[model samples]
Target: MIRFEDVSVTYDAAPGPTVQRVDLIVPEGELVLLVGPSGVGKSTLLGTVSGLVPHFTGGTLRGRVTVAGRDTRTHKPRELADVVGTVGQDPLSHFVTDTVEDELAYGMESLGLAPDVMRRRVEETLDLLGLADLRDRPIATLSGGQQQRVAIGSVLTPHPQVLVLDEPTSALDPAAAEEVLAVLQRLVHDLGTTVLMAEHRLERVVQYADQVLLLAAPGEAPVLGDPAALMARSPVFPPVVALGRIAGWSPLPLTVRDARRRAGALRERLAGAEPRRATPTEPTPAPGTGRRWAGLRRERTAEALPGVVAASVARLAVRRGRVEALRRVDLTVTPGETVALMGRNGAGKSTLLSTLVGLLEPASGTVRVGGAVPHRTSPRELIRHVGLVPQEPRDLLYADTVAAECAAADHDADAPPGTCRALVDELLPGIADDTHPRDLSEGQRLTLALAIVLTTRPPLLLLDEPTRGLDYAAKTRLVTILRGLAADGHAILLATHDVELAAEIAHRVVILADGEVVADGPTEQIVVSSPSFAPQVTKILAPQEWLTVSEVRRALDAGGGEPW
Candidate 1:
């Protein structure tokens, strides 16, 4: 139902075309997944379906693009509203209304659907996405996952023939992501809808795609083929596929189950072998620095409490209107600790992060960061103790150019002039210094926000969904920076749904459920034990101790030959 005939697009800002000579067809009623590294034109490709490519985005399209027998060249986004629904990476930017229910209905209203039909679809979408409880909540007040659901629901309510999503599940927790994908499956199988989705979280959606559309690189022709076939050679693939390649499995497994069945011998070989753990950079001696030999030794359980509490939340009761976002939530992070906060969507993970940053006041109980109450501290004084990179990175950025933002960060924190700029280089290499912050890709924006927050070098750092739009390379850079900070006596609490990331860098894991703390312990203890939270390697080598592809490679390098 979607066809791209020699399509090429070039934006006004950048050199050359981001997408070029992309000729492909997506059959009706099938789900096509767009896979590629960040800034490789995944979003730019999706924009062509609804005519957002050369229309709203102000780009030049060199070839024809059609959807449902309608040429997008002739149909603007407003004219094609009934045929295609598009959700970009940033959900907040897509929202035109304030409340959840209103936002869901707004699209239909714009399409001029009858009130009765719109209401019915609105209710159906609310139930389908578990947004019934949040129907009336203001969009701005909802958590990132909740906002993601609302953005999706708003589009789904239109009942379009084609649905385009960019990183649809990046903000969602495991179960909620499953729900969204399940709904898409139903749409494709039962309703004969065509869904074209672009996502960085391949493990969550690869198993469900009817076909894979691989964008090799800028100015390179795109490849369309079977999911497993494309994944074997693709740089951007799920961890399960990587594990399959490592073990020499035929027809590389797209899902964990397929890999697990072929993992018996590999599991046995790895049972006694230890994977290489993440190592922190060399210590930079500073007062209260505890990471002299970080990552070399596992955190000791002998001490009930670690030294120098960076932040603590005790009996925290937080409410957002009628919703009890957090109930009696008690958590703590010590200096040099890197904790991963995890849970299903609407499970109070974001709420907990907000509480840490003093954005939300607990209804009851006490909270402290660096021995000072967050909400009670002044803005000028707060930066020294805590810094937060919010789930929506755009919220933290306001300046026009990347240079201006970094310079502002340096000035704001009283740091050296080039401190933030240097951090930006370390995190997002090759990005132009003078580019507008608004023009950068989602991953680049997140990196800039992280740099800004790190400029202050607070003892405690809180990041919500730090890897949302980051490619593996960018994500690797972020992991290295975070590890170094933790080694330099910094405490980090990151809220994320990326299991692989959590497994890679997190020293400990804390799981929240229904507004309460459900599980908290060492990273290996929490993630490797839970099926839903387990990383790809953990799934394949279940009953063993492996947690990442790097770990498997490490075990193999330590003299364990191929099990097969």
Candidate 2:
């Protein structure tokens, strides 16, 4: 349904074309998966089909692009709304209404559909996307995953033939993401709608892809072909496939089930081979000294508490008019500990977070933070101890300069001189102090916002999906910074879908289902034991003791001795 012929798009600010001479075609009713590194113009390509590139974004177009027999250059987004639907990574930015039902009906209303048709389509979309239960809830009260689904539902209500989503499930938890992917599969199979999506979480959706489009870095052409063949040859793929290829497995497995089926055959071929020696463990420091320090830190945190809880909730019953949002929920956080809140979308993860921060008032029950209740605490006073990096980074940034923005977070506080400045410098160096914050890249803006939050040195830190748009290297850096903060005894709470990150940094994991904690325990035990969670590479390869890649390498070296 979509075709790109010699498409080369160049922005005025960019020295060269963001996407150059890209010749591609998507057959009608085909599900195509687009994969590439960040900032490689993957989204730019998707914009061509939706008529957002040369139309809304204001760029120079050099080639012809058509969608459903309509030329993109001649059609605006509104004009093509009936033929094509687009959902972006950030759902909040696209919302035009306050309630879920209203948002879902927005597109149909825009198309001038009859009220009866709009009502039927809205109900059908809600059922298809599993948003019926939340149809009456406020859009701001939904979780990241639910909001994203709502965004998709809003677009799908018009019955578009083609759906183009950019990283649709990036912010969703494993189960939530699976749910969204299942809906997409149904749309393609049952509804016969064409789909073209760009995502970084390849392992999740790659197995179901009908075709794969691998975009080479800028200045090179895109590679398009079969999914399995592309995954086998592409360097950028899930680790499991990489291992399968290295082991020389024929017709390599794409999913875990496929790997399990051929595992016995693969193992038999290498049976006679010597077992590889295991990697060495990290040296244990004087055990008693480490324990003493940990004990002392805990004591210090406890003593600092003034017998008043930083955050507390009792019988917190929140409702969306009639339906319960949070049913008699109760939660608390102490002075120093990192808590990971997890659950499927619409299970009140974001609602609970918002209640604690006083953004959403509970329908019933008390919520106390540092002796003052949520509704009772003034916004200025709440800023003293609680700092939140919301799901949308753009919501928090309004300042002009990068340095000025970070400094603003501590404008009224008594932070040490140059502390905020130093924090910003550490996070994103070489970014001009005078440069506009909006002009920075997405990753750069995320870093700047994080730096701003850290400037206050709040006792409690709450981050919701902090790793949304980060690349692999950026994610690693964020892990390091968060670990450092946790070690310093900051009571950190992260609501995220990043299982690997939860395994690596969090000391504790709290699984939420139906607005309550279903499982709470140490990170290692929960992640390693839970089947739904993706096991870290170290845990999978060396299940006994290793958790990180470096640890696994060290263990292998100790067992085999240093080859070099």
Candidate 3:
């Protein structure tokens, strides 16, 4: 259905082609997964399918690109609307109507379909996407996951044969992402619709893909082949694939179930080969002091307060008119602790975070930050106690320079005038000091935002999906910064679907289902023990008593060569 013959796309302002010499063919009725690191032209490749590349983005294109036999250069997005359905990473940006039903019907109406046809298509899409109950709900009130589903439904209502989505589940939680992927799988299996999707979270979606298109970095050619083999050799792969590569498995496992089976065989083989001695346990630190020592010991210890509460939500209930976003939710956080807020899309994770930060007033119940009501506190006063880094980093940046952006958030009036400059310089290096905040790369912008928020040195820091759009290096940088802050008495609450990040950094894990806390406890207990919420690596390895790579490495080192 889609073909790219030596296709190259160059943006007006960029130095070179975003996608260079790409030759790909997506066979009809095939579900192809496009995987790569961020900014490798995955979105650009998808745009060519629906004529959004040279048409909407104002770019120069060379070579031939065709969708369903029609040349892309000749067909505009509106002209190809009948043959292809395209969904972007940001659902809100693509929305044409305010309500779910209207959005679903808008595309068909634009095509001048009959009223009966539009109504039928709308009803079918609502049912297929499980949005029947939320037909009349405002699109703005929907959760990230729900909005993404609505975006898909709005495109699919026209019954296009091919569907192209760019990081459709990037904004969604695991459960909600699963819901959207399930729908996509059904559309391919039952409805015979072709799917071409680009996603970074490969562990969740790789098992269902029929083909894999692996794009290398800029100036490199794309790799295309079987999903399993590509994952094993690819530089960017999930933990399971990494394990499979290390284990020397043939026809490597792509899913947890496959990994589990292979792991069982490997364990049996090793057990039969030799008898192993019992491993010695390491000495535990004193009750409250974790593993920190020396210069950082005092800061780590100060993070643990005996009786001080950082944030509290009591019987909180939020409603958008008649629809309840959150219902009677209660939670609490303490200083120096890292709490992970997890839930499927529409399970009220964002709503709960907004209410806790006083951005959204709860219809019922109370929210307290450091024993003071968040809603009652002034915005300036709240800045000293709590700083919220929203999902979209673009929303927080307004200064001309990265240095100026950080300075605007500095709350210390008595401090030196160059304090913000020093802080930003310390946190973010290599980024030009005078570069426009909006012109920097997404990862750089994210770092700049974190630096800006940290300038205030807020006691309670709330980050909503900080890992989105970040590469491996950027993610590592973020983890290092967050760890330092958590060790220094800051109460960090991260709302994210990146389970690996939670396993690595979070001290506590809280799972929200239907707007209520279904599970809450230590990260090890919640992530390792729970079946539904286990991290991908944990599911594959099932180590005796470790949740992170560092923990596993420590255990292995102490075991004297025993496998963890």
Candidate number achieving the greatest TM-score relative to the actual structure: 1
- What overall lDDT goes with each candidate model? 0.85, 0.72, 0.75
Q: After superposition, how far is residue 79 of candidate 2 from its true place, in Å?
A: 2.1
Residue by residue across 1-564, what tens digits does model 1's lDDT show? 998999999988678998998888899999999988877899889999988888888879989898988898889999899999989999989999889999999998888899999889999999999999888888987888889999999999989999999899989988899999999999999999999999888889999999999996777889999999999888788889888888898899998888888888888777777766543223222232234223222232113123478899999999988788899888888877888999887788888888888888889999998877988888787777889998878888998899999899988987768788878887778778889887788888999999999887888899999999998778877887787777766788998999999998887889999999999988888998898898888877878877888778877878656766
Top candidate (lDDT): 1
| Model 2 residue 447 distance off true place after TM-score fit, in angstroms | 3.5
Clash count of each predicted structure: 0, 5, 0
Runs in model 3 deviating more than 4 A are 265-307, 399-448, 542-550, 560-564
Q: For candidate 2, lDDT tens digit of each residue in 1-564?
A: 888899988976666887887898898887899876656778888988899888987879889999999999998988899999999777888899999999999988888999999999889888877888889989976777888889988988988899999888877878767877888888899888999998877767888789999875766678889988888766467545654665566686777677655555434433333332211112122214344234223233333346535577788877755557687676776555666777677667767777778888888889877676766788777766677888777778898887677567657454555566666565545566777776555556777788777766566778887777665545666765665555454567888787766655666777777876677776666766776664434334433433343333444445453222
Q: Give the local distance difference test score of model 1.
A: 0.85
Better of 1 and 2 by lDDT: 1
Model 2 has an lDDT value of 0.72
Per-model TM-score on C-alpha atoms: 0.92, 0.80, 0.85
